[model samples]
Target chain A: MDIIVCVKQVPDTTDVKIDPKTGTLIREGVPSIVNPDDKHAIEEALRLKEKHGGKVTVLSMGPPQAGDALREASAMGADDMILLCDRAFAGADTWATSYTLGEAAKKIGYDLIICGREAIDGDTAQIGPQMAEHLELPQITYVRKVDVDNGKIICERALEDGYERVEANLPALLTVISDVNKPRYPSVRGIVEAYQEKEITTWTAADIQADEKCIGLDGSPTSVKKSFAPEPKGEGEILEGTTNEVCKQLVAKLMDKNVVR
Target chain B: MEFALNKEQEMIRKTAREFAENEIGPIAAEIDETTEFPKDTVKKLGELGFMGMTVPKEYGGAGMDDVSYAIAVEEISRVCASHGVTMSVNNSLVCWPLQKYGTEEQKQKYLIPLANGEKLGCFGLTEPNAGTDAGSQTTVARKEGDKYIINGSKVFITNASQSQTAIIFAMTDKSKGTRGISTFVVDTDTPGFSIGTIEQKMGIRGSVQAELVFENMEIPQENLLGKEGRGFGLAMATLDGGRIGIASQALGIAQAAYEESVKYAKEREQFGKPIAKFQAIQWFIADMATEIDAARLMVYKAAFDKWQGKPYTVSAAMAKFFASDIAMNATRNAIQIHGGYGYTKEYPVERFYRDAKITEIYEGTTEVQKMVIAGNLLK
Candidate 1:
């Protein structure tokens, strides 16, 4: 089983700064980290490899600096790392990113594909499903639990109130959530081996045979008009009385605003 | 002239810091209060390839450098000195000597497990009568055919109660003085081998310190570490590396104390504003930060010298004494900065103060370290 994991490097800080004029992230001076969910995805891939016996390869489509994220995945026991680094892949939105990653996946070949449910920096939650569509492979998104055996995969998809169990054949993609499993820290030996011994295979848009028109800024369809923190709403009224009375008051106030039917 | 850690070393440091903060930090105070060995975390450290960090890969170690090992010890000690010392004794005192001096069979039987963290190992050299004067150790091992009958006891042995294996130094030929000491690998489960009194400690209570009694304890002749009568040299060589670990431990303690003091100074208010606004508090923080940075560099340099295969005896001694002195001073100032709260158990500075004292005493006293450095200069 050759499992390929898609990862993204995002600014380490939670208070992400945006360029007011450009309507893009102000990334200078900020440290980068493998997106939290992407790390969980890598950990799951390694866990599956350990159980099913196969190579785990981590793939990312970002700048050359993204190689650091790939190396970190390798340190977490991934067998191979691939960084799709090219100036042609810059300014990519989720759509172009997925298209490029999907093309790289097709070139690498995989029995299983795993992606994070979402990157913290880009909370669109579209790349995994979009990539699945590009490859025409079945996908289980928001996956909290997984069981793979006999060339089949079973996953528990977390929903609003409960969960939905889905089964798929081999050669499937899964977008894992944090609840899937607690990730393991990279051991000291693993870190040394990753940097000293392992080679991170770099791929370009041309190398993956990606459509040039469908990559980078030219490829992205959606552009942010503006991004800013929303102002806090006015203070709320405190309802006092029994629980039922408070609930009635709340519903009456919500109805007055037509917030809910 | 480069002060930065390499990529590998940086990764190791990051991993150790994360592990120390998340896994060990929460339990440090609890374990210290209970005096219960952090068995689970120690096992986790083994899985993280920290137990035998500096040992070679073929022997089930992480095959890391001495600086990386020191960084790891520092991080662990920053959160919990007990765990730090446990890891230090294993890597520096036990695994190092075995890898350097043990025969193929010895490596196979003992080094592998100890390095892999499957079994714990302790070094036995200090006796009740011999502390700084290690040359006067009265424990004797009489050679009898294929076996040695060891009839003496070692006191203040770390990990003694829990260890499965020990590197025991006994006077095989007392008539020859310190040169008569021979090193042997003795199984703690051997007949007539027993753990004596477990000492109640002032600090690092999470780690056990006990007396090891050997009454006619039989050790296999093949278990001898290096040639006969060479134990003293081996022990000294081992301490040279061990001091690096102790220095790192002290550096970590100082770092913790300094950080705590800074935090308290900023949050604690005495006058119209935070205590940090005062010049007195500012000076303490300044002095602590300076000392900690210097001590860290000294510890790292000692570790680097050892890694470069340089003669590190005097350097290790220098690092040990300097870092430990800094640790004591830093913790003292940390308590002073925190005022009454720092003296209480609520703050970890008091614990740091207690733990720092041991670093100045164990491995070698500050006076002993000075003697080592001066002795070299004089010679």
Candidate 2:
């Protein structure tokens, strides 16, 4: 099966810094990493490619620097990569970003689409399902396992209370969580081959036939008004006891506070 | 003049860092405490092309440059110095010389497997009496038709018992002194070959040292490495590259120590304030960061020079000497920074402290490195 995995490069939240003056992130010195959940998505894609003998292509819509993420995907065993980079795509929120990727996807449609459940930066968890809607395909969210046999695709999706198995025809999109699988590090040979031979096809907005009205900040409906760290909550009590004792005391305290049973 | 690592080098660094963090970090302390070699992870490292990173792709290697090898060593050593040395020895000592001097058949037979990390190998140059003065080796080899009867014992050899093959150095003509030395690719399972004592070490305990005794051990003449008299020069040249690996290892240890101290000073409190606020602690941190930066530049310079086929002996020695000194200094201060916590095994810094000492002593001692540098300078 031909697979297209969408990925993004985000600033490492572990070392994030904020600009107090502008109420925005200070990204000058921050390290950029492939989105964590997207790494799992790639792992799943690679695993699928390994199993049924198919091609895996990674697609991304971001700045030119996002090619780093694409190269990383290739090193992790993607057969091809397409990077949608254009000044017209800057300052795009989820709507505009998904629209651009939707256009790119239409231009380079695949038998399957894979994405991370959510981006740590936005935490919106909307892009994957939004892109699926734009492409007019069904999506399985929070997928922990993917199985393809015959002409059908099967997924086990994680839910809050339990998990459900979902089946769909070929040409489907999946948004996976971290529980899917651990990503493998690229081998030294893989890194060398990726840089030496792989070409990261850069697609401008016009190349993907993206609508000017549906890209960049000009296309987004929502706008951020302010940004700041949330107020620090006071520390809660640390309950230390045996497992059974801790469970009894935790239940008793919750009952006393009327928080839960 | 460029300071930034290229994209490929950066990726290798990131890959090594992630692998070291995920696979080696958790078990590093446990292995050090138990003195158990992480055979599984080490073999995986080989499969990942770290064993013979500098060797060409045709030779079953990752086809990376010396610079990448240096980066890999530094990253692995950051979490586990024992794994670092194991990789360094395979890349620098065993695979390196064989690639440079071995014949086509020899390359196919030995270098391929060694580079592939399919088999472990050791360099048997340092004996009981031939530590600093390697030319004074007491081992002897007598040629008999197609075989050489070797007789001697090599002590303080790293990966001795674990290695399946060894580059054994012995005297072919005792009258020629240094020129008498001959190197052979001897299988450790040779009939008369026996593994003797295992050393109880201070640091890098996971990668143990052992003694190999050869009593009339028969090695085929085709197993000879390079020319008979040229063995010493090959060994010396191999060490020139080996020192870069050692320097990178030391840099990793120092970096680990430095990072631990910074984390400690920030969280550790005194007088109801973080200890990092104190000028004494700040000064130590500053010194450590600056020294690490300088040492890294030196190490990278040597690695680059080696890749470019330039003269890098003095630079390697300088890097090795300086980096190992900084390692000892930084680990000592890291323990000082943690006060009591760093002294205990609970913190990884104690193991880092133990691992740092070996970098100065192995490959070449600090004094040997200085002599090499001074000797080059005199010319």
Candidate 3:
């Protein structure tokens, strides 16, 4: 029942400010936080480990500062952590990121690998499925609930409308949605233990024996030419009046616009 | 030397703040109006490891340093002062002293559940006769062959009625005066122990204070805490550390009021513009901001001194006295900033006003704090 969770550290979207002139985010003052949905993935993995007797390991591929996310994961009851940080891992797209993660995953007894369905910053939703492809294991996406039995995993996956149930055998991957479980805050005791006791192992490119040609910016095929905030739109009308008057006005306006007959 | 909190401390503060805002903030006003105890929230606080933030992990506590405890208290108090006091009395006055002085057997029986927040506990020091002068005790405990009979009553005891455990002090030998006091770990369910009455308080209504009566209450000799005659020192030691918690709590109340005041002042207009345009309003806001920052620094300093094993009695007293005073002033100003609306229950400033006064009076009074500070200076 050994489980591995892949987490990422991203700029706190709430605090981010964009430079209108440069059409880029001002990263200097903004704080870095654990990717929001990734916490749910960690929670799901921990819950699974709790029910079935096993250890939970959190692995992350980012800059050295990503240790903050790994440390946070540890505080949330991760059994151990590995920070896949290296200069060579810079400028990675989702494809290269998953390949590096797959290399690290090979070293562990990964009965199940869990990840957030999508990173909010990139919103690619590709890393989970890509890692699964690299590992040659079945992968479940948008998982909201998980139930495990003897070498069998049942995942209730969320879809565009309603949801669907999917099952996979041992050595599978799951990409969880934020709706999966309410992530628990790191307990005070857990925080102290994480800081005072746990050791977070840091791995470089050579440590994981990743192929030079298939790692870092060299391997990333995707490139962004420009980024900018969309132009603001005018505030929408409230259509405020008496309930009957507002409804009548709304209907007249919609009919005038040919929206409703 | 560093003003910044460590990473772990920040994490604890963030967790407490998030819990307070998301879970406690919505119901805080309602709880104040009804004076209903938030038992479920308190239990959640315990499960979150906030009830015993500074206790060591071995004793089923958070194992955080005193500074972290201060941050936790301040953050919790910022939202609901009721929860603040409940957590404060548990961590500072009960679990702390229990960890320090309790025998291994006592720690095992009482400290485990208390530190883990599985059970709630209270300190029974203030009584009918004893308030400012804690040495004067009317409660008597006469030793029997294998047990002691406790008689008399405790008043204004936080969590008295609801707590499962209590660390009570009583006169073991009347002739020895203050030295006669002995501390005992009393289980609230023991026969002859009763909750007399719940006090109708002006503020912090969520966590009510109650009277505890001990009539012919019997307990085993093993329940004795520290030494028989050394209870005064133990009690004072506990109260000294307790000051840091209360100070932090006061800082939280003041911080909350200050924030509310700014928000109100910004949107509230009097003469064609926001009231914030007036120098009078701006000055009050400025003073509150400055005082809160100073009080916060003092609290962290006291907590840091305690963590470093320095003699922090004077600093703790200073922090308690100054912070509580600021809490009272800031809440009053918050109400003033809101004008007529502040006096009404429609806003939370009125509740903050009521909660602020208690901080200056509890744990140790402002006068008591001054005396402690003066006494230390004269020494």
- Model 2 accuracy (lDDT, Cα): 0.91
Interface RMSD of each: 0.7, 0.7, 0.8
- How large is the interface RMSD of candidate 1? 0.7
Tens digits of per-residue lDDT for model 2, B1-379: 5788999999999999999999999889888888888899999898888899988889988789889999999999999999999999989999999999899989899888988889888888998889999999899999999999999999988888889879879999999998989889977888999899998888998897899999989999999999987778888999999999999999999999999999999999999999999999999999999999999999999999999999999999999999999999999999999999989988888899989999999888999999999999998
Over A1-261, each residue of candidate 3 has an lDDT whose tens digit, in order, gives 999999999999889887888877798978788999899999999898889979999999987788889989999899898999899999988889999999999986689999998887888999999999999999999999999988999999998998999999989999999999999888888888888889899999999999988888998988778777877688899888899999999999999999999
Clashing pairs in 2: none
Ranking of all predicted structures according to TM-score, beginning with the best and ending with the worst:
3, 2, 1
What is the Cα-based lDDT of residue B356 in candidate 3? Answer: 95
Chain B alone, model 1: TM-score?
0.99
Better of 1 and 2 by lDDT: 1
| C-alpha lDDT of residue A239 in model 2 | 88
- Model 3 accuracy (lDDT, Cα): 0.93
| Model 2: docking quality category | medium
Off by over 4 Å in 1: A14-29, A229-261
* Residue B184 C-alpha lDDT in model 3: 97
Tens-digit lDDT string for candidate 1 (A1-261) = 899999988897575676766656688878788899998899999988888888998999877878888888988899889999999998988889899999999998999999999888778889999999989999999999999878899999999999999999989999999999888999878888898889989998889998999999899998877777555489978999999999999999999999988
For candidate 3, write residues B1-379 as lDDT tens digits. Answer: 5678888998888889989998999999999989999999999999989888888888989888999999999999999999999999999999988999999999999998998989999999998779998899989999999999999999999999879999999999999999999999999999988999899998999997999899999999999999998899999999999999999999999999999999999999898999999999999999999999999999999999999999999999999999999999999999999999999988899999999999989988999999999999998
DockQ for each numbered candidate: 0.77, 0.76, 0.83
